[model samples]
Target: MKSHSEMKEIATRLKRDIIQLTSANTGHPGGAIGAAEIVAELYFNRLKHDPSNPFWEDRDRFILSNGHICTVLYSAMARSGYFEVEELKTFRKVNSRLQGHPSRHDLPGIETASGPLGQGLSIANGIALSNKLRNNNSKVYCLVGDGELQEGQIWEAAMTSAHYQLDNLVLIINWNDIQIDGHVKDVMNIEPIADKFKSFGWNTIEIDGHNISEIQSALDTFEINNGSPTAIIARTVLGNGVSYMEHEAIWHGKAPSSEEAKQALEEIGTSTFESDLIY
Candidate 1:
């Protein structure tokens, strides 16, 4: 397990990579930036995964339900040895495995091909249930955007998880208020998030998503909890590490220009991880 500081540095590097990758091509960056810490803790510290052996049978499954923010996921995957970090430059490039959204067929570590809103949880449910049937003790971690809650399919999956008592599944809600259209509340209020999860018979926990320790503790709690699935409501700022982008709905799907990315990287500071590219 990595120390909290090391994990934090990894998140910082992830934020930097997110900016560089998306700025090179059009892609969503806000939610990806906001969830950097969560992704860091999971890929670098918490998840039971082996990049060398992508199809490890008992490895934990991480489903990016709101796949639009996959820039962070891609960064984490490459940094974690799922692929060469150098390949990151090819993001959204023609015939590159890294598409605008994650594709399980294209990427080695990706658990599923995700893009359309509100389908990830259901996919996770199927995987979790399959694990249960096989008596597999591996956990399933699903990350969903708060804005994706507007989809009726998400709720249906929520009910299914609770009803089936998928204790091995962990659901993380990236509760950053801003979506592509605007603030989530302005688009469609999904407030009282934790309460709603609790009502669905889930064991819910709320925490500051940017806090590495809080993220670690929440995952720890999920591991210990039995008889119900866990839902972590991680409150976060959209575009967390970038001043101009933070909490601004406009940055949700907007790629930073070369100038904007330069500024964002300056604000993010130097990363512990070495980058192949200077920018």
Candidate 2:
């Protein structure tokens, strides 16, 4: 486990990378920023994978249901040594391995190609069931957007996971309360998300998504849980860490200009990441 201070620094650096990468390619920045801390925590602390062997069988799996926010995942993968961080600059470019959404074919670390929401949970269910059959100790972690809960397939997967008692799977909901169009509540209400999961037989925990300690505690709780799938409702800001972008839908799919990127970087601070590569 990393020290608290080290985790904080990692989160900050990941946040910076998210901003820079999204700005460079004009991809999804809002959700990426919101998910930075949790992504950092998972990649840096909880996940088991060898960068040297990208296809290690014993490695844990991560599925991003809300694939639009893959900018954050790509940033984490780069920093975690799956690939050179310099590749982040090519995000969303034509023929780049890093597309607008994650594709398992192009990226070695990505487990699934997800963009059309609500399918990730089902995919996770399949992987979890396979792990159970193989008696594999590897855990499957899936990240879904709050807006994604509106999908009925998610409920079916939720029920399947519970029925199979896939304790090796962890479902993380990025509860930023904002989506592409507008506020999640305005677009579609998913209140009592925890109760819904509990009804489906999942062990649910809610926490401050941006808090490293809370995130760490949630992972520990998942480890202790048995005979049921785990769900973590991570409350986060829509555009976390960027003053001008927080809770604003405009930044959802918009990229920052060079000048705007400079200003945002100024606010995020550059005195952190071990690597000096910040585009």
Candidate 3:
């Protein structure tokens, strides 16, 4: 296990990578920025997976339901040794495995190809059920966006997971207020999200998504609570790390220019890449 400070530094470096890579490719940055800390915590501390053996049967699984935000997932995979960190710059480029959204066929760490909204939970349920039937102890984790909750399939999956008592499955909802169209409340409010999950019979917990320790604790707490699927409502800003992007829906699908990327990198602090002379 990495120390708390080491985890923080990894997250910071991944955030810097997200900003720089997205800016280079002009890809999604808002949701990616918001989810950096949570993803970092999971890959660096909570998850039990061997990057060298991507298909390890006993390994835990993670699915990115909100795939547009996968820039951070790709970054985490790279940092975790699933791929070369330098490949981050090829994001969204033609013939590159790292596309605008995640595809399991192309990427070793991605468990599902999930660009469409609201389907990841159902996929996670299937994986969890299979694990249970095989008497396996491996767990499944899925990350969903607040706006994606508007899809009816999410509620169906929620009901099914609880109905079958799939304790091996864990769902993390990125409850950032802003979505592409506008604020989630204005577009389609899923208020009292935690209560909704509770009503569905899920073991629910709410936490500051940016707090690494709290995020880690929530994952640990869920593991000890058996017989019910868990849901973590992680409250976070839309664009968390940058001054101009935080809480702003306009930045949802936009990328920073070269100058803006430089500023964002400075804000995130320097990394080993700075001295590598590889701009």
> Each model's TM-score, in the order given?
0.98, 0.97, 0.96
Model 1 spans with C-alpha error above 4 angstroms: 276-279
Model 2 Cα shift for residue 269 (angstroms) = 1.9
Where does candidate 2 have its weakest 10-residue lDDT segment?
270-279
* Candidate 2 Cα errors over 4 Å, as ranges: 276-278
lDDT of 1 at 247: 92
lDDT of each: 0.91, 0.88, 0.88
Give the per-residue lDDT of model 1 (tens digit) for 1-279: 898888888899999999998898889999999999999999998899999999999899999988899999999998999998888889999999998898888888999988899999999999999999999989999999999999999999999999999999999999999888888999999988988999999999999999998999999999994899999999999998789998999998999999999999999888776563553
Off by over 4 Å in 3: 271-277
Over 1-279, each residue of candidate 2 has an lDDT whose tens digit, in order, gives: 998888788877877887788777788888888898899888999998887788898888889999999988988898889999888888899889998999999989889999998999999999988988998889999999998999999999999999999999999999988877899899889988999999999999999998989999999999884899999999999778678988998888888888877777787776355664555
Q: Against the true structure, whose lDDT is highest? A: 1
State the lDDT at 98 in candidate 1.
95
Error of 2 at 163 (Å): 1.0
